[model samples]
Target: MSAREPLIVQREVKPLDFLAAGETASEFKELLKSLGIPTDICRRASIVTYEAEMNTVIHGGGGVMSLRLEDDAIIIVAEDQGPGIADLEKAMQEGYSTAPDFVREMGFGAGMGLPNIKKYSDKLEIDTRVGEGTTLRAYIFIKGQREE
Candidate 1:
């Protein structure tokens, strides 16, 4: 309850698990709501969670999603051990997805994952390496402190 103590929540993502993906996103939204987070912030967080979850499922081949609540910000971190992105620049572009045929056929990978995450989160950081995997950290400002 104090600024010195932060709350963290995490969930494991499975490769291509559509049902679990939805569940994880919903759980995050509900958790945020129960914590008295503003509805708008909750929505933004959920959108970011869903996009990051999808990327983990469809492209990362499984990973972990975590949410951290601090006194001034909400942080979401997604980590994966799958093959890393070769081109960060191209991956950030909208409509530029590396999803395979089946993933696209599932109506999920339109290459908007990173773009949507950026749109909803106040700040985003991506650390990626080919063949190594990636770690994405997204922050949403709260309590009117948004200079980061």
Candidate 2:
């Protein structure tokens, strides 16, 4: 006998969600908790999801965030249809942002999104095209959590 696995959960990130992106993170936190994911992994996943969701709202035009729980890891995929990152290397830098003044005024887009996402996730994959779109895949394993 084995414990039941959690079902896949997907949420659409509309431009409007930008006004309340924090809610997105909250939603994931609650869902992961309900699914019995380890606290550390859930925290990491929440951070990555929030960052990725913000990127979609601020840059990706619009996208979808999907989550799945595996026996050993949590998988998150954020896909958006918007202008892709021109320079992946440059974009990966912390505190580097291309957000306009309005977005900046909204207290988002401080350029820490990608860097933070990479920092917390065990594995990450980013796919983008200049004019096509972008897809980010992040994984957090459920073992060896560190104390805060």
Highest TM-score scorer? 1
List the candidates' TM-scores in order. Answer: 0.91, 0.89
Give Cα distance to truth, residue 1, candidate 1, Å: 22
Backbone clash pairs for candidate 2 read none
Clashes of each: 0, 0
lDDT of 2 by residue, 42-129 (tens): 7888888889889998898888887877778787788888999999999999999998889999788899999999898988889889
RMSD of each: 3.7, 4.3
Can you tell me which runs of candidate 1 are displaced by over 4 Å? Answer: 1-5, 145-148
What overall lDDT, based on C-alpha atoms, would model 2 receive against the true structure? 0.83
Q: Which candidate comes out best when scored by lDDT?
A: 1
Model 2, residue 51: distance off in Å is: 0.8
Lowest-sum lDDT 10-residue window in model 1: 1-10
After superposing candidate 2 on the true structure, give the runs of residues whose Cα lies further than 4 Å from its correct spot.
Answer: 1-7, 146-148
Residue 117 alpha-carbon offset, candidate 1, angstroms: 0.3
Candidate 1 CA-lDDT value: 0.86
